[model samples]
Target chain A: MGLLSKKDAKLITDPLADNNPVTIQVLGICSALAITAELEASIVMAIAVLFVLALGNVVISLMRNIIPSKIRIIVQLIVVATLVIIVDLVLKAFAYELSKTLSVFVGLIITNCIIMGRFEAFALANTPGKAFLDGIGNAAGYGLILVIVGFFRELLGSGTLLGMQVLGDPIEKTGVYAFGYENNGFMLLAPMALITLGIIIWVQRSRNEALIEDH
Target chain B: MEKRTDKNSYTIIFATVMVIIVGSMLAFLATYLKPQIDENKRLEKQQNILYALGINDNDEKSVVFISTKDVAEKFDKYIVKQIIIQGDKVTEDDNAYLLDLKKEHAQAKDKGHQRRLPLFIGEKDGEKFYIIPMLGKGLWDAVWGYVALDKNLVVEGIFFDHKGETPGLGANINQRFFMDDFKGEHILDGTTFKGITVAKGNADPKNERKEDFKVDAIAGATITGDGLTAMIKKDLRMYMPYLQTLNK
Candidate 1:
């Protein structure tokens, strides 16, 4: 309870649902659409974002007082960029193939609205502990959407899950649709990702009427 | 403290310090990780070379996929010679592996200079294969690959890769389905250097000669396909001087 009071726990949990970065805030949609084609890529991207966000939040929060208000945005950017570079380097060193697959998206994490938005809105005002939790929570929310989208995309688009052929042989290989199931090529495109996100928003808003915006 | 935090001078000083700290931190990380990154790149390059040669665990019948650890060892064992060719002459001065194709191509294009091209000679099961490195511009960024040729200058196999091509379209060049089309395509037609062409659709029907000089291009990736075609033709043409010597 001391480590995470009820208020602190909300900082971590609220973003997972109500204040979700991808669904509610509509932040980090670019990467969410781009890397969610495959489950493996989505998971790698999620972890990378999680690492950058949490560390960036804590670093910026610690320096909040010392950072001049006029140049605060620049300071936040520097911190985020540094963390992103570190993540990029570590990924290149250890997970070379996945890093290559993710390509420029990882480096572009510095520009992701969610990280910058949090630095401005939460980390600058909050304590380091709260900022850290908020960062993790928001990134988890983003990751949840990515994984869900990736699951459907990989399964429907390629008849595979995480590169494993769960739906027997591909139509091309089998020369006929296996089990009368054909890959939905539409799911592989970016527009389909937007549609998937819209569906998610619809489901969330319907389940929780508070999420619906009043006209 | 409040006065200092509000002052422009303090902001400048803070920014300078932060930049220095971040710069040094990045520099330190880059330097520390260089060896490991380089090792990974080396292994990947080896794997690509092996893949281009169509010598994998499946061919060797050991494993379904060749592990990264085994790539370097396999490369060393299979790749028998490293040849550097410059304008009809085999140069022993430069190491083939060290020849950066991108840089060399840039220098050649910008300054009208000629540079040595690297040709890797690989041997497997009593057959000799010639592997040529290719570099060209894609729609968005650089695309590159290795093409392995048999004794008659016919494509034995290929391994294409891109830097920043569009996903599901141009980036599909990395897929085996695309690269496999290059196999058995002739780069040289009886001393006539007619590099392979990535035809619009299924080249099998349109190709009158049936000489394996044309392969089908990916739909909706016309630019990338054109880039690949141009890359292969241009790069392979540069090797003609060396390839001519091989015929002699």
Candidate 2:
């Protein structure tokens, strides 16, 4: 898990590509859709989720034996939420404007299936270090899809990336580029996130024909 | 053999400890940051009001010139009075301009206690501006906005936002064309009360005397448009008697 061994390296790096969460496992798609409208906001949200999910997994794994079997889920939830409150407070302190922009998406990270999925699937049985790496890799997988979706959505939706003007205005305003800077503003909306994510799934599956052909 | 604790004892201890730790931590955090959060919300409200008034305070250099105190003073001096009306009676709330509606909503239900409505009156140059709060139903939830008027009671500007409305359609109230269409439309004429109307196409081309204040509903968002129209008409109609005081 420290990158000292082959099996540990495989567990850590594989989720980045072949065993990707969004592309392969298809976990955590809800936040991926809700926050991927802006590249800046999506990146911020991704980092926050990565921190919470990984830390929650590590802490829960560390406490695995001591936690009563009957109330394990509740314990995990409490730890995750405490971490979330800290993150929420930090954001309100340092990034008040962005915090407002992100709204409830930050708090919703607790409900994100990726964190709980890892708690149930990886954290309970796995070593603390391995559980942490697994959490990081899975979070990276979620972040990858979000960044891709956000890249396209922000570019097309606003004719800008990270709020900077990339595509020039239509000829009427004296700039170039024919795709038109006018907001197909719908792309900025949440439904567009679903459509783009669906497309990503389609393309990924088509390339890996064995997934479809296996049945 | 290790002494095994009773299951009931562990359960009670765990719940109690977790509750105390989590609850105290939250209490501590809230106590520390509540003031900063309150200040941010206050500044944000001031900015919203400034935007509605069409005051350009964007330049970084101007940030030094425009502080919350400046905005508050300007708002206080020019936006002179706040009136609360229920049925035919009108009473004044001195701090109505500063009153937070989010706080106002939490008061004990007084079926008999009157709802204190705040009207912001700001003057620029010599013209009086009436800033009225507009609230109504949107497609999915409650929509609220501010409609500002000049001394003549013609529309000045509007700033609308909603809880959950379709982004491209109903949410277009945030756009200028919709809000600007409200500018220059008079809500009253002397003693006769002519409530503002929201029309389709173009409002039956106004006369020279009444050229500026006309609102046309956004074409496709008929339900939202109708709702907004009804909202403005209803809220302004309530403030009609209070507004008549400005003419004197």
Task: Say which candidate scores most in DockQ.
Answer: 1
- Over A1-215, each residue of candidate 2 has an lDDT whose tens digit, in order, gives 55358877776677776777777777888778766766876787788778887888888889776666666677778888888887777677666665654455656688887888889888988878988878888888788888899999878886667756577753234454554336566787678889998898888778877545343
DockQ for all models, in order? Answer: 0.43, 0.26
Candidate 2 wrongly placed segments (more than 4 Å): A1-12, A93-95, A126-132, A154-160, A163-192, A208-215, B1-12, B59-94, B100-113, B135-143, B161-234
Index of the highest-TM-score prediction: 1
Of candidate 1 chain A, the 10-residue stretch with the lowest lDDT total is: A170-179
Q: What does the lDDT come to for candidate 1?
A: 0.81
Model 1, residue A158: displacement in angstroms? Answer: 2.4
Query: Candidate 2 versus the native: TM-score?
Result: 0.75
Superposed Cα deviation of residue B205, candidate 1 (Å): 13
lDDT for B33 in candidate 2 is 88
Structural RMSD, model 2:
5.6
Question: Which residue pairs come into collision in candidate 2?
Answer: B78-B122, B78-B123, B79-B121, B79-B122, B184-B212, B184-B213, B185-B213
